[model samples]
Target: PTAPVAAAAAALCVLAVSPGQAWAASADGPDGPAAYETAEGAKPVKGTAGSGDGPEISPGTYTDSIGRGEKKYYHVDLDAKSSAFISAVAAPEPGSRVKGVGEGLKIRLETVDGSECDGGTEPQFSAEGAAYPVADYATRLIGADDECQKAGAYLFSVEREGPETSDPGRWPLELRYMSEPGLKGGPRLLPGSPDSDEEPGDDETPAPVTSGEKRQAHGGTGFNDAGALAKGVWRDRIKPGETRFYRVPVDWGQRLNASVELGSANSPGEYPPTIYDGFGITAYNPARGRFEDDPFVSYTPDESAQAAVYTPTVDYTSRFDYSTNTPCLAGWHYLAVTVSPQLGKFFKSTAPLTLRVDVTGTAKAGPKYAGDAHAAGFGVSDEDKEQAEKGQNAAEGERSDSLRIVAYVGIGAGVVLILGLAVWTLTARRRAEALPGAPGTPGALGGPAGPGGQAGPDGGSGTV
Candidate 1:
């Protein structure tokens, strides 16, 4: 074979073998801990972040459903190189029989010196009817130029707001707290809420998908124990201001897309005049960190009589860059859905939010860094890390072995074919040269019989 043909065959073979290695690399890449892994190990801590006696907390999910009208505080310690993310998901407002004014609960993050971290007072209401829950979240980096940037104890408060009521039922709170590595010992900018900026406008509304009769129950109620789902559409429920957290495992090079489908109101009409359906959805990376300067607003305008969907493509995490601001690394990414309250005296019955998650592209692992497997703010356990490393090594070895066998067989077959073709060509040439009437050879018609040399039917020279 010519050099060009040989090179072409080699290129084809490389292309054929590349996919298997790439796939194996993704399936066995550096596996991080599952989402909400810390939820199971979180210890119960009660009381407030003040009074010099608040219970200390760490990276985990905690719950509170008892003790009505009592203020609860939890304290988290921060290092000089870390930032904190705190979220509170409150249970739906309970239905009351007695008539009373609407009341609310106050949640705030503060330092010991009385500095507010993030978020303001959010109201809670109870009446003669049923109401849904509420979900509020906040994030603060422990550095300069921000409130409570010092490396010390910080407070997370949940207290009663508005007028006191006779309802004795306590609110079930799903609390999530995590401390991630800060950037250069400085406070980074936080993304503004889409809900705050949305107004009643004439922008084109996306058509939402309707839920089918067949549905699956979500794994858990809150972000801490978020249910695991494969790519496709899923049907689930969320009350007023209630939030549900779900996680999808995306490989290093995969693209993740998620959207929420809220039930529409009565008929094909506009949203209720008095009701403002507020819903928002956002996603976080495996390290529970968001991409920097990349405005990620999955869904806005929280409510619609028709279905609402927000699907955005996520950039694959890179292996080279370790900056917390950039979206890098792989593992279980988080999707949070928040449903705001409706202040009108109306009850609209409709299907639950149909969450559609589509993951495309081949899985390729991001950069592998030694040390903390969960350095990107993930709670990866030592066992999970060990298992991932072992599995990766085994899979890679298997792939290598299989590829070696295939490569050997392919190369051998290719060489044999080339040699057979070369021999056949040589034999054909020799046979032609040995022909009886071949040119420049001694044969029956070797010399011209006539003036012009020409071969006759009797194998003798004839006159032209």
Candidate 2:
């Protein structure tokens, strides 16, 4: 906050180009949006029924290792009549001791070619934890006119922002594909996806790409430190200090918006009333790389699961946090921040918090073109998942000067486009009017000319 800072935050924005949007409760699961809102006056309303029963998933269930410093992705290829959705239903290996808020899991989307999200128009990756932990946020994608034809992919990664560890557990998570609204998964694992005729016929479904290949080491988190320790929330006591660290995998230089819930209590004596809670400010960047001292402020929660909200437009180094100031007491709260949606449906299921981060102020601004954020590796990856875990930035960070530079460029571009259109329209009208035997009227354009003004047959001088 000392100097101006860059601003960034991903959000659950409806990218519909048609009239009227319809929001619905996911029959796929019981929990969704409104239930996860952490902000005041911004909570979402209940949802009703929806259209399109899920088509059979081709590669039904799959799994990966997600090494210490790696990001693992999977694809759900849709046939003419079938479609698929990717959701994280279980924790990635219990060894990481991951738990609490937005700590252990991040989901993303990507393209088969591995480029160009932002035009995302499919199901995003969503999360559902076993210990009643919120996905923190999930994304909902409005329908696309060309949906059944396009393909979708999902990215799953390990995040250790709460309790820390490097072990990728071996628990068998169940990821299934339902063909219709009323269908349920079998008692044991099905062979391949319902979409695939090849029934592997068992609980064992290995990912297409095997593990121990590249061995990219990274950190991960889960709902219970059940495997690593007994703790299950964000705390510094285990590690101590006002500063904390967390890391998530990305394609490099991508936008990441993040937030955390906080709470704390009193000790036997007054040793400054021990501070324990979520952070408000944090510093991070790719150069220093993942798994380092994060750019977040020290925090102490006033309650647990009491429901607190934090809307952070966090940057690579900025942070976002909940409050503990009496009236602003913080305890077991919920924080939701979208990392990036440049990739597409990668975030459709996260059921993210409601506020939209206007990266316009602190973001890179863009080419000032009419397109949404589909730049190289910049937007939330809808290309497949854009993980759409898309790293999250703190919403509490201050604005930076780079924001203004982008504004000026946008204004200048707008002026140029207006001028260009004016010229083109004028030229086209003149050419139409100058046609042989065309009308000599001043306004010989697409509409009717003025009274007393002459009009040629067929409305133009160039009559067929």
Candidate 3:
């Protein structure tokens, strides 16, 4: 055959084998509903299992996807010395509606016999306006308090918090499980262990509004008119969906630390076991705009009685930068605390929330430049002022991951084509050289007559 025809045939052969190899490579790949790691991939251990009889999952990060009403179960074997931390991250589906009260996803850690190790908690969200792709996590430490710390299979289940109608769509779910082995030998107390003996510091800083000093009643009726809380530990109460915005005068070169403590008024047995409420603390820049990579503090208090309060702190640096200026800005930064109420829960009434703002570092003015006089505010640069004057928003970054994958595949195909063509050319030359009478053979090219003279060429018929 001609060289082109031979090349084409070789290319076909390579193409034919390429698909099977691809299939073989991906037959047990990490693409499934419950994508996770397994010990054996050949004997084909399942990576996606949803039922109570689902496959055993080791401690690692897994990429998976799930739909509404679909529950995925994974079993992790934990010994007495190991504590488990498991979390799931998924973006909420757009246009998803909740029936009555919206519920976030639920994560639970249970024993082999189906008894819960950690008092399974559900992630909290504002039924009306919670963003997507929130990180929901749960942790369980095996200590003296946990009676279910047997050395056997413990089930990890993920499901929607409420009825299926609250949310829909096959959202991508990322599961991360970390099994921390305790210090070898006898009982040990981890630093952050709930059973730690350390007590609250006695020399606590006095709060600003000591429940006595008449609050400046900024009567922050809504988010816009949040009470102007100064840089001190303040006390206040927030109702459901009621936001209290406190603007702190943050100057340049000053780092700020703020914390909110939510207090429970009712006793332990005042509410049902499943009743719970969530408090969210968010900080906006001087412009009341969200900053990229800003920390969002949210805590949910359930029936487990430790004290009546959950305090979470958020810290940010006040740096002057035109880029990523949200968290790094200064001047009139607003902190808002919003309570999401569960209608029948303990937080249905007003919940007292404490706000503490601490500022450190000396106040220094920003860099002086040609356009410093026209600078918009404390952290806004001259370029930002120009953009704001033009009313232009920042451009979004491009997502070209799939394009990169396609480019890689194209390069691989080119390599295969080149290798196949070279092989075909070499094979063609070897066959031509072995022909009868081509160079040293006894038979001639046109009239191939060898000593045997039995066939047309090479002592055989010309047909290939």
Question: Best candidate, lDDT-wise?
Answer: 1
lDDT of each: 0.50, 0.26, 0.47
Estimated TM-score for each candidate: 0.46, 0.24, 0.36
Writing each residue's lDDT as its tens digit, candidate 2 over 1-464 gives: 11111111011011121112211221442222211112222212211112122122333333222333333333344433322233333333211233333444444333444442222211111211112121221111112222233434422222223334423443223332222111124212212211222232221222222222222111112211011101112222111111122332222212233333333333234443222222232222211111111222333223321221222221211111112101100011112221211111222333111111111112221122122222211223332121112222211101112333445555565556556666777887889778864556444444453345545333643322
Give the root-mean-square deviation of each candidate in angstroms: 15.0, 23.3, 21.8
Q: How many backbone clashes does candidate 2 have?
A: 90
Per-residue lDDT tens digits of candidate 3, residues 1-464? 36755665566566445433321211321221112121122122233444467767665556666676666787777776654566665444423444433555777778767677643546545434433333344445555356566687778877755564466667656665655445334234222211211233322323322333323323242222344544445666655544454555554555445667666545446443433334455555443333332233334353222111111111122121223223333454556554544421456556666665655445555433222222233352444333222222221000122333555576577667667768888997888788866764455545554345446554454433
Best by TM-score: 1
lDDT of 2: 0.26
